[model samples]
Target: MSHFESCWNPASPQALQRRAALLERIAALRALEDRAAAASARSQAVFDKRGQLLPRQRVALLLDPGRPWLPLATLAGYGQDTPELARSVPGGGMIAGIGWVSGVRCMVVASDSGIEAGAIQPMGLEKILRAQEIALQNKLPFLHLVESAGANLMRYRVEGFVHGGSLFRNLARLSAAGVPVITVQHGSGTAGGAYMPGLSDVVIMVRGRSRAFLAGPPLLQAATGEIATEEELGGAEMHTQVSGLGEHLAEDDREALALAREVVAQLGWAPPEAPPAFAEPRYPADDLLGLMSDDLRQPVDMRELMLRLVDGSELLQFKPLYGAATVCAQARIEGRPVGLISNNGPIDVAGANKATHFIQWMCQLGHPLIYLQNTTGFMVGKDSEQGGMIKHGSKMIQAVSNATVPQITLQCGASFGAGNYGMCGRGYAPRFLFSWPNARTAVMGGEQAARTMQIVAEAALARKGLAPDPVRAQAQFEQTVALFESQADAFHTSGLLLDDGVIDPRDSRAVLAQCLALCADAEARRLRPLSFGVARM
Candidate 1:
C-alpha cells in the first residue's frame, strides 16, 4: 500500500479557525453528556445512605477495565423530556454501551435510576430497545443493570405503555436467538417491570435492594386488601429460594455486579483474535479536526479525511475520473478491508452510478462499506434531471439498502435530501452510524426549505389573484428557518437519536476502526438458535 502525502497545514489560519470551531462544538456535546452524569450523581447521597452503588458505578464494576466501551444513544431523549433545551437531560434516563465483560463483548445497559427514581422515560424505552437490537444483530450477550421505578405514572401516555410491550418481546427474541439476556436487578422492578428479570436467561438479584414484583405493597393493598413486606412479595431471597425467579443472590450492588461478570465469563463466548499488525495512518488524526470547515456549504476534499482514517493513509481509488464528486476507494481500517464511499459535493448522475457499482463490488468482495456522508444531496437542475439523476440515484439507494455486507456511516458534514438515503443514513440501518459535531442532517438547508415554501405560497396567492403580504411572508420565513436550524444542528439531531452519537473529529480513525472491528467480530461469531426463549421454569 502506498502512503498518502499530506497537503493539510495545521498551522494555517483557516485550519486553526476550523479546529477552534470544531473544539467548541465538541465541548458543547461533552457538556450535555456531563449533564446527564451530573443529574445521576445528585442522588449519590441517597444511594450512599442506602449502601447501594449508583447505576454508573454498577456498570463500571460489571465491565472489564481498559477495554473499549462504545456508548450508544447518549443523546437519546435530549429535548423530548421537556421543551426547555437547557434543562432537558438527555440519555433517555439510561446509560448504555457495547463493551467487554470478562473478555466477552456484551451489551451493557444500566438504568439511570438516580434520575427521577430511574423512571422509564419515553426515550429510555427506545434506547433499551435499540440496545437489544444491536445485541441481537451482533450476537452479543445482553447484560442489564436494571433498577427502574417503572413508567412515570404522572407523565404516562397510553402509546408509550402499549409500545413498551415490545421491550419484553425483544428480550424474549434475544434469548430465542441464543443471545443471553442477563439482568442484575439493582432496585425496584414492579408491575410490568417484573418481566425484565423474568424474561432474562440469567437473573442476579441484590438481596436487600433488588425487588421484582407484579404488584408492589401499595397496589397489593389497594387491590387485595392484603399487604406483604417487599421481601415477602419479591425480594432477592424470596425470588431466589422460594419463587425460583432469580438464580443468583447477592448482599449488595458490588457483589451482584461481580456475579454478573462471573456469569459472562462462564458463558464460554470469546471474540476472535485481533487482526495481524497494521500500519497507522500517515497523517496525524488530530488534523481531522480542521479537515473540514464548520460550515457544510464549504467544499472540502473527502479524500483528505479518508487518508487520515485508513491504514498507512493508503487508498486505491475506484472509478475516480468518472464521478469526481463521488469518491469510491478500497482501504483497510485497522487491517479490516473496507470499501469507502464519500461525497465531495452533491452526487450527480455519474457519481450516483459510480457509487451504485462500487457498492455492489464491495458486497461481492465481502468487504464492509464505510459511508463518509458530506453531501447537500443529489445534484438538481434541468440538465441534471435530463441526465437520468433519479434513475441513477435510485440504483445507488437500492444497492445501499440491499447490500449484504455491513455498512457503517459517519456523517462528516451535510447529509440532506436524497443523498441521505443514497449514502446509508440512519434509515438504512447501517451497522453503526456516528456523526461529527459539525455534521448537519436535514431535508435541505434552512434557507432553501424556506424559499421553496415561499415560492409555493406565492404561486398559490397568484392563482387566487392575491398579493403576498411582506410582513406575514417575513414572519413565516423566519419561523421556518428557526425550526430547521434548531433541529438540524448535530446536537439536536443526536439528542433525538437520529445518529448513534456525535463524536470528536479527531477520534474518527479510532472510532471507525472500533466499529469495523465490531463488524468483523459479528461476522466471525456463531450462535445456536432456539424456537423459544429459555424460560425461567
Candidate 2:
C-alpha cells in the first residue's frame, strides 16, 4: 500500500502565522454573516406582535429537525445598497437552501419578512432565480415561505421587472419537469407576483395574512375605480374559498409550514437508496480548516485533500508520476464510486492529455467526477506552446463537455482562465458547483492582470515616443490589482450567483455527500412526463 506521507506542520511558526491570518479573514466574513443574521433576528419582536413567525423560524419549522441545512448565497447583495461593507446586510432579502422536509430533501425559500417587510433587495430577484434553477435541475420539491412587498417601485429598474418573469416561468418549468412546487403565501403576492401561487403545484395560505392579487386596494381604486377591501381583493380566505388560487388554508405560520412539509411528503418522492459501505477518512475534518490558504497564488497538495475526503483516506492515484500537475485519482466518497481531478499547478500539455484520458475513463466506469480547482490556467510561454498545450487543452475540454456522468466542482483556490473552463466552472454546467470563502475566480490572478496591463501601457507609450511616468504607472497598477482582487473574492462571486454558495471549509465533506446523494437519486429515479405541466383547477 502506497500511503501518502504528510508534509504539513501544524506546530511550525510559519504554519501558525498563516493560519492566524486566514482565521482573521474567516472571522471577518463570519462577523458580517452574523450581522446579517442579527439584523433579521431583531425583527422577531415585530413578528411576535403580528402573530407571525420570523422568516428563519418558519424555515426551521418547515424543515425536519436535526437534518442538515445547506444555506446558499448568504452574501447575495452584500456591499450593494451602501458603501459600508460591515453595515450592509446581504442575503438578498431571502433565506434559501436545501434541507430535509418531511424526511425528503427539498429546496426551501423563505422571505426575510421581518426585515423591510420582506421587500426584495437589490439582487434578491437574481438570488431566488438561481435557487429556483437549482430546485428544477436537482428535481427537488420547492417550498416557499413567502411574504414579499414585491419590487421596490421607488427604486425600480425596467430590467428587474423584465427579468422577473423568468421566476414564474421556472415555476411552470419545474412542474413540467416533474418537480413539485409547494408555496405558503404568508403575506402579499401582489401585481405580477400573484403568479407565484398561481404557478405552483400546491399553495398554502395564511387565513388573514396571505394576499395574492393583481392589484392592491389603491391600485384597484385607481385602475377600475373599484373600492375593494384587502380581503375582498386577494385575501387568503377569498383565495382558498372562492378564487381557487390557493389549495390549503392555514391559521398561522406554524400551521402553514406544517402544510408545506406535508405536501412535500405527499409528492410521491422515492425513498433514498441504500448507499455502498462507507468508511470514515483517516484524517480529521478539522484539518480542512487549515488546509486552505487565502492567497490564491499558493499551491495546494491535491493528495492531502483527497486523503481527507475519500473513504478510508485510501486513493488509487492514476498516473501519479506522469502529468504531475493534473492529479487524477480513483476513490470512493461515502463509499460511492467517484473519480477526482485536482491541480497541483497549471495544466500543461502532458497534464491536459492525462486529464482527457482520465475523464473518458471515469465516464466508461460510470463514476461521477469531482473537480478540485486551484489552477492559474493552462501553461503559457514558448515551451508550453511548442509542447502542443493548445491541442491537449482542447482535447481535455472536449472530453469534459461530452462525458456522460455527473461532474461536481469545488473552487478551493484560483480558478482562472481556460483552467476554469476545463475544470467545469459555472459556464460548463457542472451538476453542482461550490466555493470556499477564501477562493477566488477570475480570468487570471489580480497581479497577473495588473502586470499585463502595465506591459500594454508601456508599449502604448513607446508607440507615442513618450516615457511613462513611474509614479502614475505604479498607482494604476495598484488600483487595477485592488479592483480585480475585490471582484474575484468569493463574497463578490457568490453575490452574483457565480457559484452555488460560499461554504466553510469544515463543512465541505457533508455538503459534497448531500450533493452526491442527490445526483445519484436523480440518476436512479424514473420520471413521468406529460405534454404540459399540471394546470390549475
- Best candidate (score: lDDT): 1
List runs of model 2 lying over 4 Å from the truth: none
TM-score, prediction 2: 0.97
Best by TM-score: 1
lDDT of 2 by residue, 1-537 (tens): 356766776667755665676667668678877877888899887888889888888888888889889888888888787878767887888898999988888889988877787887768888889888888777788888889888889889898889889889988888888888888999999887788888988999998899988999999899999899999999999999998989999999889888887887787777888798899988877676676677666667878887888888888889999999999999888878899999999999999999999999999999999999988899999999998889899999999998899899999888899999999889988988998877889898889999999999999999999999999999999999999999898888887778888777767788888888888887886666557777888
> Where is model 1 poorest over a 10-residue stretch in terms of lDDT?
1-10
Model 1 per-residue lDDT tens digits across residues 228-268: 99999989999999999999999999999999989988989
Provide the clashing-pair count of each candidate structure.
1, 0
lDDT of each: 0.91, 0.86
Error of 1 at 104 (Å): 0.8
Q: List the candidate 1 regions with Cα displacement exceeding 4 Å.
A: 1-4
